[model samples]
Target: MRITVLVTAKRNPDLDGAACAIAYAELLREEGYDAAPLVDGNPDAEARFALDETGWARPAVSMSASEIVLVDASDVVGLPDAVSAERVVEVIDHRQHHDAERLFPRARIQIEAVGAAATLVAERWRAAARRPRGSTALLLQAAIQSNTQRLRGSVTTPRDLDAAAWLAGIAELPDGFVEGQFAARAAEIVADVDAALSRESKRFDHPEGSYVVAQLELPGAVGLVDAVAAADLARTERVMVNLVDVDSARSLLLIWDSAFRRWVAARLGVTFTGAGAECSPAVLRKQIVARLRGDAS
Candidate 1:
């Protein structure tokens, strides 16, 4: 039978995107719809760790689907080849620099600036008055913790906090679970920073400029700025590297393009001592994009 809803995230989703896909698909199935979660590419190290910890495996999903629901993904570029823009019936994302409505014209869109898209999916479970299974709740809870840095990130919202709290009651996550997740991710990054950088990179085309932003997130990535060699990120196109310390809540932006560096310096009020500049209380990539596109208030 054809799948009614094929829920997915970006090409290689992190925990936030992967959790939303699986959890929202569960919600759809509970509502009596034929739905399943499918990721086009492999999830990142952090997501892999969570899936293993929760023992939440991906079930079979039909490649040909009647409709698609994109969670934590908004742009056409991130859409998998199997999911044509016309097939996307719904888009639920939490980013400011989004092209959801414009790209997926027929899709019902919800693009808020919340910390994690999983927060919205958790709210749906609460709205329906249906409790998710323990593993599902755990996944959503982990995603919120990762995205919001345990409710310390600047993008965190009250909705994120409430959803996390509700899920906490259901999940009963173990003590030091967040710490373990962070340590696992840090080991993966510190082992091979270049690969970590490549794994988490994303490209954007805003009205201000078209460029790519590569990110590395861990507890103390701020110290790894000089070792990152972010100056070589730009092969032909403009590229910027953001090394974010999620624990301490700091960001170090590495600029390879001098002209673009000047632009960012002017916009963000930062002076580059060398090729990198640090911003405390860390700013997310979406926030930078929002500021440049005038989406920030």
Candidate 2:
């Protein structure tokens, strides 16, 4: 029997990663390939909101295909052990990695520096004169907007904005869609802060040490959790929880490790005056992880 084609993102995929995997697989299937999108791990809270908003099902946990297409991430370290570089037949990503060419030399690789991988997938669809419909369009649009922080994040590029504009044109979004989505996520956090934090938390290994970084959306500046709950959410030696007020584009950063606290204060050119530091220019958890890994010696 012929094996099916599996398209998936890295483990613990966020909005862009999950959306890209599903969208790209649909694109391939339209071209007559037996393709399916699977999630390497469970989606995060914000990603779940997008899934629920579009009525899309959560991705299957595993793929039995021998050959696979990777989306949103290029580094082999981020992939599962069963998916080796040799099995990667193609790569689609917005984040650039130095080892992509070396790892998947024979695969058709696209590593653009856009804010979201969904932008790249949309560009491909537009090039083929194909428009995503219904849930796919909605999820992809939300992924673009969320990753770009409603087009206000520093990581956003012109291509990302263009893709978002195209997606918005096709998607049957509600009035004030972006704002409504953020508000929904904030409400979920308020309903259960512990569940929200646990779903959003991700860990990274740095030269200094391994640490957990988590984030949550808040309707306003009123979302607060006790230290015990915060500590319970962390599974690493150091942890940083960022409570982001999406409407205002600001974040309250709570740090646990003293060394990391000092490092972050120095890096951001700020002084730690209280329990947590308020970042005027809101920072995403992905940006924090990038900064942490990039600064490692």
Query: Candidate 2 — number of clashing residue pairs?
Result: 0
Model 2 clash pairs are none
Candidate 1: global Cα-lDDT? 0.84
Tell me the lDDT of model 2 at 118.
93
| TM-score of model number 2 | 0.78
Q: What do the candidate models score in CA lDDT, each in turn?
A: 0.84, 0.75
Question: Which residue pairs collide, candidate 1?
Answer: none
Cα lDDT tens digits for candidate 1, 84-136:
99999999998877667789999999888799999999998999999999999
After aligning candidate 1 to the native by TM-score, how far in Å is the CA of 230 from where it should be? 6.3
Each candidate's TM vs. the true structure? 0.92, 0.78
Question: Looking at model 2, which ten-residue stretch has the lowest summed lDDT?
Answer: 221-230
Residue 27 Cα positional deviation in candidate 2, in Å, after optimal superposition: 1.9
Give one digit per residue, the lDDT tens place, for model 2 in 129-240: 8887768988888888877767776667899889888987887667676676676666667777777677767777767777787887555733574632455664345788
